[model samples]
Target: MRASDPAIRSALDHVILIKAHLLQLRESLTALEDVRHSPRGVVLIRRCMLDVRMVFEELMLLSVSAHGEAGDRVEQSLRKKHRADLKIRGLNELNPNFFPDAIDLVASDEPGVAGRFTSVCEPYLTVEQAKRIYFRSDQLLHASRIFMSTEDFEAHRGELIEFYGLTERLLRTFEIDISGTGFMVLGHLNLDDDAMPQVFEAQTS
Candidate 1:
């Protein structure tokens, strides 16, 4: 929280902005108990899903800014493990430092290495899942013919919410326990269905 770099401050601000949008999306979802999707709600949710998926990429960019080579190593690991063309294209759009060769960034035990960062990320989102979400979000962004049924919308809503919370915890607290079950710590941090919707309303109003 006390970092001197302007980039760190920017990263924090971006995270807060992303969180706000995600919260607002949830607020929209709350009004749809009987039906799964409204036209407005669908648009908002898709936008938020795109943003939620970008949360990690943004963080990785920040990590690259802070740690340079170490961060590059992690990004490269993610890229190599991630085979999808859509995701590769997305990665290409990010900072060049986030691309490079030759390091096991995910499993390395060395202190201050990118592996620590990747380790924190692997459980919540593997490269494969990231690619899937990235492509789906892109499709939704383009107003492509992709359609989400009521059930699909609900499932995506839940998954995006969890992803947002876990990414938040990793970015804000620098905590990661791959050994532990799911993001329980994140669930405790105001991400619950009951907890966040109320707080989000209060903050927005």
Candidate 2:
């Protein structure tokens, strides 16, 4: 896809939204500490779960946006499927290449010249990760019986922390390769104050 392609633009827009979601996730995670002893602690946990779930959903939508029309079809199909596992499986089938295996953080010492940098291509937050978190969130969000006790809820705190860690690593500075054209690098220069999506493009090898 060309730099000016609408799909690229849309994907970048999603990136912006994802950044906002991440910010919310951070707030929810921090609040967990303050409420750990309070009865409302469960609320914070639910918020965290919701935030993680949103990130997963937005990531899927962003992937779909990268594919243009084909992605649109997958999105339509996803709308009818309420199962998170199926949605992820369908997206994987649509095109696994749509998801980046690793993100390259290119550093440039001079203007307009790409330089050496680090690559984070670890297999974190893959489809399986999404499925696990998504379904867990669903289970916690829609309680079929009495809500989890504080002890039970506390047990899952470790998992929530892990989710945040993996998500941060995945989005800290990542590259999404656009087939046939190039790839887009989406991240934040300063995640605290500069929460905006900083996007850069480069040709694929």
Candidate 3:
């Protein structure tokens, strides 16, 4: 895509960088299939850390679209924290994936934990909703944990299993190994098996 606005162009550059970082993350993770306990994935993720920030910079400048209020939080986190933290606390606030907020649950459970999460997330979930919310680095990291979950969630969940078993050691590996590999797999993938398209549409878009 081409643009006449310098800021918008800059934003696209950041988006391109984000895409590259994600690709690298995938490559590193996939590399661990044969190499046992490889730190390669973590290393790649570290490199992409900066790229993640760039994406947010561009997104906010462009303001080209919206993923609801949650997106605003992601943008703020990028401004306040380093790229590395984005994976830890920025990911969740920016990208909730399937985790819906208040607007999503207004019709379902009104007095449950899910409802609570949604409620806090709502009024601010959509760009049209609250207009803004406090975005923090921790939220990004917390969000990434879920955002980068493995392909087969049902088989090995909450086991703290990273990439095959790396989830348990995410701090050291930057994990969520799906390629049956180690951190060398780089921690990026598109498929959210059995997930609704809307779950990841914001990120993919």
Candidate 4:
């Protein structure tokens, strides 16, 4: 699809919002280190899980928004259901091509290079990975432990960190193949500077 197409623009807007939530998730994960044994640690951990949930929710919404009228029916059905697994499955059935198979990071050969660039593709986030993370996050979010102990927090620390890493890779640079003829790439030019999200376009077979 063309960059100016309403569907593409709407998808870009979703990317921007998802990026903001990802930044917040990163902050929460980083803050967990100093207070992992305290009450504040539990709060941060929960916040991280919440952020993940929100990210997946937005992703589903983005998919629905891109499909027009058919998408509206799916959205309504989604409203009636509250299960993450089912929601993911529903979205997949609606459009299996909604999620990209891998992320593409493009770099210039030299400082002044204009047209000379190379892209490295990494298969980090896939539908299965997303489902795993989403399910785990939901479980942790609704766990029975009201005030989790230090050992309990430690037990889940590695999993949470892994989830964060996977999520970061997914958002840092990825493309969504909307159809057979075109795809959209979304990423940041300079993450350190908090630059605005940028979207690029390319044609495919």
Q: What is the TM-score of each candidate against the true structure?
A: 0.47, 0.80, 0.29, 0.77
Candidate number of the best lDDT: 2
Q: Over the stretch 78-184, how does candidate 1's per-residue lDDT look in tens digits?
A: 55654336446544444332321111123546777443222233334344555566666655666657666777777777767665554444333232111112111
In candidate 3, what are the lDDT values of residues 124-171, reduced to their tens digit?
223211111113212323423433323422222211122212211211
CA lDDT of each prediction against the hidden true structure: 0.45, 0.67, 0.30, 0.65
lDDT of 1 at 104: 14
The worst-scoring run of ten residues by lDDT in candidate 3 lies at 196-205
* Model 1 per-residue lDDT at 32: 49
In model 4, which regions exceed 4 Å deviation? 1-4, 105-123, 143-146, 179-190
lDDT of 2 by residue, 1-205 (tens): 6645776677777777777777887887788877784557777788888888777777776766755775676667667887777777777766565554445557778888676446665645665676787898867887556767768777767788887777766666666654323445444423567646765554434
Q: Which candidate, 1 or 3, would have the higher lDDT against the true structure?
A: 1
Best by TM-score: 2
By TM-score, the better pick of 1 and 2 is 2
Residue 49 in model 1: lDDT: 67
